[model samples]
Target chain A: MKKMLLLYVVVIGTLMAYLYMVYFREDNGGLSENAGLHGKTDERYVMVNFLTGIDYWKNSLKGFEDAAEALGVSVEYRGSTQYDVQEEVMVLEQVIARSPSGIAVSAINSEALNAAINKAVEAGIPVVMFDSDAPDSDAYSFLGTNNYNAGVTAAREMAELTGGQGEVGIISLPNQLNHQERTRGFSDTLAKEFPKLRLVGIEDGKGDQLVTEQKSLELMERYPGLTGIFVTEANGGVGAGNAVLQAEKIDKVHIISFDTDKGTLDMVKSGTISATLAQGTWNMGYWSLMHLFHLHNELAEPMPDWRSSDVPPLPTYVDTGITVVTESNVDQFYAK
Target chain B: MKKMLLLYVVVIGTLMAYLYMVYFREDNGGLSENAGLHGKTDERYVMVNFLTGIDYWKNSLKGFEDAAEALGVSVEYRGSTQYDVQEEVMVLEQVIARSPSGIAVSAINSEALNAAINKAVEAGIPVVMFDSDAPDSDAYSFLGTNNYNAGVTAAREMAELTGGQGEVGIISLPNQLNHQERTRGFSDTLAKEFPKLRLVGIEDGKGDQLVTEQKSLELMERYPGLTGIFVTEANGGVGAGNAVLQAEKIDKVHIISFDTDKGTLDMVKSGTISATLAQGTWNMGYWSLMHLFHLHNELAEPMPDWRSSDVPPLPTYVDTGITVVTESNVDQFYAK
Candidate 1:
């Protein structure tokens, strides 16, 4: 009886040991330890942006986060709560102060972010811009839509909508670099390529839905024969769509907008809006973080022109890609 | 004159000092110092999965990386290059050996990944599953689509498409956990909710375009009066659309697919596909990382029973959202 009891005790001890190692042991370098690395002071990547609340930023953030996970790193998202230049600048400054492994920013103001971004680069913190950009910043790269080309695409789409001969108006955010570029591209293309189409008015929507709607309504009133309207942002497009819908002028006015927020897509499906320019938002987020990770880890050398190289040898600004979303193809955009 | 020269030199020296401190100094933390933290670190973060090359994973990685960047940490993505169970197991073991910060896995096989996942959890590293999940694992959380519910939504959509009275077939990835759940939801609902809509056949597309196309063609041959086909993935939808186009059955057969890949969307636009279920892929990628970040940082406590507390309290399993896309709304999905 004594021997049996002793043997049972020994067996119990072995089982306990195995359980501890399997369930409670801290194997920091083991495969299990990888899951423990989160929020533990070792995160080395940061993604900066302007107005992080928008759906447009969501995919990009996912891309940034996905890359971070793959590389065994952590990331933080900091951005302006609103589309205020000063707020964006302040956020960038605070991010710079943290001295993270890397920084990816979306420039709200091209000139405002320049000094601070250069400071980050000089201090060895690699920076990459997305969505919008600062062309003169010392940042190593810019990962986002080729705004100008996208605008050109939008122009062609508008011309198509108007049958290449009609008066059209544009509602845009003039100060923002991407919007500015898109506007320029659209206008330039319309002028050079589509002689039959005349651009009547270019109004600033100020990136606000209500403002855009009001402005669009004003444009409609001002240009009685307006055949089409191009909106450079999601909110603007929806607002413009609403304007057309409310006016019951859907048959006469064709609206093209940017981005794919729920409201915008819904309008398109309902024929309130005609078409939209879809950017490679996923690519922007994915490549932006990838570039930041590489630069942060010194995995790649910085190109001579950081702003241009974000997309790398492709173009200073990567037209990650653009798709013309029409009712026929809208099913593809549905989330699966 | 000598005094003035000395004053000029002093002023110049002061300006240079300020510039160096502001612009050139390693103010944020030096990259070299952070680089050392990732080097030979005992803690690690591992992302495990099946078929890792898909675009959806890109955003998740970005989230993981963003967290790493902010926390000065590291992570690695390891998974099967193909949808193979054995390969996933092998990768999991390799990751386990390295001892990571935490593990975020998208289980290809609930049972196959069970032992390895349990091993990681038992080893004292927190494990979280994303995209697809292993419910039985000791994982702290599952961050991904509420696929079963998504399927129910798809059923409602199909009913709308076929006027609730026609036969439909399903194409799915047979072995995938999420797809299986989706199929189950869809099948159960069609039987109980829409009695008039009969499900005639189920085919395995293997999530390949060519295979899906071939299988859909065969289904068409077998069921000449098939009114609609539901594909649980993007490629299958595109493939099914192609088959329909080839068969010249566009008016008779309606195609509803999942996800928002360009190819699938194009078909939807062209009227080859009736509609698609767009998953909140961006949300999946974003929220997964947010959960991982919080879990790893110990910023938030893990829920006691993710399945139970999933909908309320913390929302463990989020129905990021799903939208029905058809030609009517295609314009809204377009980017401007």
Candidate 2:
């Protein structure tokens, strides 16, 4: 009887152990059975971007993340606390030092980041530019809103608003490449397309509200008949709006600005500003990161894939898009 | 002479080899001094979202990418081509099969994903929710906008737009948790704060243009005295604007929508729409990924360390922000 009882005990213990192995252990495994085939360990990559505290950059980062996720890789966001070139450069250096699989940058200064970008590429790290481009840098591609085209569109819209003939002034960030392109586009368009319109004065807002306000006030003073003001950047737009409000020129001084910040939208609704341009910011971030991930993982080759296929790999410069925002469609932007 | 020649050749060869080792070889090593610190192999992490095509997600992806870069790790993105739950779930399942380091999900359906999400957590993978969330899922935390508060603000703005007393209708996506919260807040505020204002109807737009248009047309028919219409999405606002335009109710009907899509802005300028609420979409995406990366890397503890008062850990939920976009500030949003 004792021998039989011992045998039963041993048998039960063996079965319990087997059940634990089959059920709990397998279920607890980190990798599930449905997971796809794994790639070689060496081919892993990560993408980096400047993400937080900036509205304009949201779309570009999304593009990057989407591409990275599709490729089964990783990405990161890093940048200056403020829009300072030196701070951006330092952040870039730190990112490069980390030797990420790749880097996607929106250059605050086209010239300032030349050395750091080159160093990364020289070290076998792939770099891509989005939103704002550094034309002279070693970064492989630029995916962003076509600033010049957007400018042309803006100029046309301005002409339509001002009845095709008026003295208009511009407040812009003179140093940034993207803003410079926009300014050029606006100027060239006004000169060529809108023959009746006069481009009177161009002022540097330094992308600051106070500076934009001061410059706008000065322009209104200098050109008393200034019919319209085009300001780039959110702060600049608010500054211009404030100038108009303080000057009590709501009806006479038409305003056009860049971005979709609250202050800009409010002015549009109240008729203090006429219209604004909205960029396809999401496309910039998404495509830039996608390009970076593909290059890093060897999933999609760099541009000049030169292969004639149904879907071309990707272009070096992708014109995301832009559109005019006006009061007629302002309700479409209100949060529920 | 032969011996002398051989001896000279050997000496020259030795010098050349030394030079190559010291300079040329080192230069051609394909690895820089910074590479050593960053070459450490680490687990991969990824985040996936629905509506991957939208502009608001860019910054969040950047934050994820930045964290991956800083951690010397990798990350990726995945999503449905459209805002379809089945497609998102398929993508999630595919990602789960690969068993990444961790996953960050922006849940489109709070309840539908519970099983799959739990499966991932059970498999030992950490899961975090960002932007829109699934509260019931095993996600560690929800990092996104405080949507309810945003709705309250919107309701207040609506009252102001309608002069504090009138009949208003809502066009909203009823199923979405975030939108549901927004509707609740808007309705609650209208009932509590604006005594003279009455909410005549709440219509489901399904977040589609034609559907929203149809819904708005029906609402207009039912409530001939409707003073305002609040739409929850950009496309919905456009649809509502079209309805109002077709019905020639511009002077009688006021519209408010969500997001800064161009269509909404255009309506705002044209006086078809009244205002919009712009959420800090960029911040939501950026910070969600940042927190996920930090948690995955163990760079910072899961919870704040009470003893270390120098740098506190990140909070679980972050209210990025909300802004009211109207004609008064419309010029500030135009492109430069």
Runs with alpha carbons beyond 4 Å of true place in candidate 1: A1-43, A302-317, A331-336, B1-336
Model 2, stretches more than 4 Å misplaced?
A: A1-52, A301-314, A331-336, B1-336
Instruction: Pick the TM-score winner.
Output: 1
| lDDT of every model, 2 decimals | 0.72, 0.71
Model 1, residue B165: distance off in Å is 80
- Model 1: per-residue lDDT, tens digit, A132-177? 7787887755666667778998999888888998899999988766
Estimated TM-score for each candidate? 0.44, 0.43
The digit string of per-residue lDDT tens for model 2 on A201-274 reads 88899889999999999999898888899886777998899999999988888899987777888888887878
Q: lDDT by residue for model 2 over B177-274, one digit each (tens)?
A: 78888888899999999988899888899889999999999999998888888898768999999999999998888888997777888877777888
Using lDDT as the measure, which candidate wins?
1
